[model samples]
Target chain A: MELYIGGISQGKLTYVCNKKNISKDSDLICDGAGCTMEELLSKPFVNHFHLFIGRLLKEGGAIVTDGAIAPDGPKTDSDRHFLLKPGHAPDPEKIANVLAKDLIAENPSVVIICNEVGCGIVPVDRTDRLYRETVGRCLCRLAEYSQVVERIVCGLGMRLK
Target chain B: MIILITGGSGSGKSEYAENLAVKLGKRDLLYIATMIPRDGESMQRVARHQKRRKSEGFHTLECHTDLKRLPVHGFPTVLLECMSNLLANEMFSEEGIIKTRGNIPVVEEILEGIAYLDRLCEHVIIVSNEVFSDNGSPYAETAGYIKLLGEINCRIAGLASCVYEVVCGIPVCQKGSGIL
Candidate 1:
């Protein structure tokens, strides 16, 4: 099952799940706040979790960090690491790869939280357009892999599975 | 064979289609319905449709948007109940309005998808509403959307092996050489 946490706002993750009566055992939280990954991992039942911190992290299962940082880190070379900076979109294939790896390795009940950035008029700015397109493609990929999918609107959940 | 049954609002398109589907005596009758209950009236409409389909014993699939994910294979007969709601869904969906620039694509993607259904299924029946007959409304967006629907209807008619326009619960064959 795939739960898509959307909207420009944050902190609705726990509230929405509680409202739906869905347990938080295998939840995978991905958000802009660099701290969400750590918080989710703190839960006793969470088997594995990942975060895409734009900056390099010395530790983590899969590190999607800034490319400008030096290659030397505590992480092994083959530990599903990515270096993508802020204001830049990660490659769809690479994101899909990480998701696939996590699905196989972690094998936890997964929920993904992402920003809803494509509900309005097209942005006149190129960067904004590119970001929206990238996010859209990423969501599509997630949907392809997901057994069930939902989109939250006005804090109400609509199942699109 | 691909057949399209279309009519204006309150013209009983759903009723006619359901009766035809039951008469066909096919178990794999796929009903691709597109309606969201955003208000009391819409909710009532949905309940009414549900009751009608339940009485008819037709298998239904609710697709509010994202027609790209529609299963193309394994169904004997597919009935896409309406296209207007699908268009509205694409209009209001995430990044939908922006992607279409408020103008629904007049190109062949929609037609191509329908053709794909043709190749995948033994029989395909599409249901649509006739919105062009009424010229009273002055809303530019509504008018533009109707024009687009007209274009889409024309295209579907061109490709459809049978085209029937339902008026007052009567089916009138408008195109192709077959009867339904």
Candidate 2:
């Protein structure tokens, strides 16, 4: 599996397409956004991991997102980590072992793209902080098993592996 | 060669800079740690960083603010751990005063610091943060902080031989390659 990561609008998808020589073929595209966990795990491309987490938060236990930003919502102590890992996202170990294992086995060249959102100050909201940590952990998990981990900046790809 | 390595938090900019310095430094290798740990979180953070660079054979000189603390000679190569903290230390007074709340003065001080480093070492590698790649305006003070970091990044990048922005632990070159 090849990991292509950067901030939003850093040309990750275009770089992947050009590098993979994948042109004019929607058949190769696997829409992973908003898919059920089973479906998303089955697909080759896992897009919108952040949104997936959001959807999971709304659907799961111990995760109550009054949403990403809440200026008027009353603050509460319920925001702190109730468990070691929030129930919002899928079990990272399972995802790494099951989905990631399957991906590496079946797909010869899988392009994993994610935006870098952990740069700024830690968010005031618990959900936002959890979201940032989740994405970061997910990326690290994926990169560990990936053959190539590339970070794109200003349309330049660096082979970090 | 002067190199600027920048990225988002947890993006491995420091690690990349260390690798490059290890690959290049043959003489007096200096690791300029700019962090001043004043709290538990910060002490833990600095400890983690120190652990990572433990076996990398670095002579860490904690120059929290003043760049002149670095030696003027003998150090062939110096890797400045980060610029963000240095800016905060220099821009803010101990009485909770903030100097150069504007961009020009902060940028000038940063550039002057860089020039000092340039003269001190034969080669310098600076690790900075990518502060402009975020959404929405932060609080006014934070927004001002980000603006200062962005300005310093631009001018120093223009002066460096190579500029790398590491995203997700990968180093992507943005300017001239330091390696021949």
Candidate 3:
């Protein structure tokens, strides 16, 4: 497995395409924003891998968005860990761990392009918090299983492993 | 020697910094904690960090804001837990209002605090967050905070003898010969 990670719009996908000698519009590249789990496993490359984790969390009912935040919410830490529906949702962290294991077992040679999302301020919404934390855990597992890992910055790739 | 360590949360930056501090220090080790526990979650975080360094013989000083005024007893190595919390504490006062003078003063105050630590300690290890990467539509004040932190990190990196961005428990040296 190969992993490429960086901030949003840091040119990770472009760097990967150039290095792998793959066209930008190749059918083998699957976008995590819309692709299914089966497609992800079968595809050679996955972009926006963080979104995939969010989708998974949403599907698993770990993300509850209704009545969570006001349209323009008051920016305060009061809502930091306030669950919208307590004891009614599946644990996102466990789901994320299982998904990570599945991905490593199902597709060991896939190339992943994920945005680094855990660096920002802690989100007031519960869903956002779970999404970022799950993404971080998922990427850590993937990076460990990856044969090579690279961090892209300003369209430049820095080999990490 | 000033070493700036930065990374996303859960990237193992704290663990890496602690290991480096332990490796560099001889007898005296000081951990300057900047986070103010507001709730259970933050308190848990603080406890977790303390548990990690339980046997390291670290004398921790809780300096949330006004780092410049915090007195240090001059340790061999001083590890400032993080810059993000310290900056937040300075940017937002106890009443939750933004400081009137803007972020320049905050940056200067933090850098001055860092300089004080540098003068007092032989090795000043600083931990900061990589908060600039995430794509969040933040409010104006939040944006200002981000901008301020980015500037502070850059200035510290410039002055740092070594800088490392910890990724997945691995320290990727960005500048200077990091403690190998």
- Give per-residue CA lDDT, model 2, range B73-113, as digits (tens): 67788999888888777776452125434344666766887
RMSD of 3: 7.0
> Candidate order by TM-score, highest to lowest?
3, 2, 1
Q: Model 1, range B1-180, lDDT digits (tens) per residue?
A: 678888654345677777777666467677888776665445655776788878666677877765556885677777787777766565555535436555556335567667777888777788876665323246675566666677888888888888876543345577876454
Candidate 3 chain B, which ten residues in sequence have the lowest lDDT sum? B95-104
RMSD of model 1 against the true structure: 16.9
Better of 1 and 3 by lDDT: 3
Best by the TM-score measure = 3
Q: What docking tier does model 2 reach?
A: incorrect
Query: For residues A1-161, what per-residue lDDT tens digits would candidate 3 score against the true structure?
Result: 99999888889999999999999899989998888777777798999998877765554422223322121222343332233245443344354557667778788889999998888876877678767766876777777788898999999998998
lDDT of 2 by residue, A1-161 (tens): 67877777878777777877875243454533455554444555655555554544443422223322222222444532322234333232232234344445555365676777777755666556555645654566567778988778888897778
| Interface RMSD of every predicted model, in angstroms | 17.6, 4.7, 3.1
- DockQ, candidate 2, comes to 0.22
lDDT of 2 at A117: 76
Worst 10 residues of 1 chain B by lDDT: B130-139
Candidates 1 and 3 compared: the better one by TM-score is: 3
Model 1 C-alpha lDDT per residue in residues A36-135, reported as the tens digit of each score? 4434323222211212322223242344343222223325554433323343433433443444444433433455555544433334444344344334
TM-score of each: 0.49, 0.69, 0.77
Residue lDDT tens for model 3, B52-146: 88788888998877776777766889899899888888778672214655536677778988998888779999999988766654598788888
Better of 1 and 2 by DockQ: 2
Cα lDDT for residue B21, candidate 2: 88
How many clashes does the backbone of model 2 have? Answer: 0
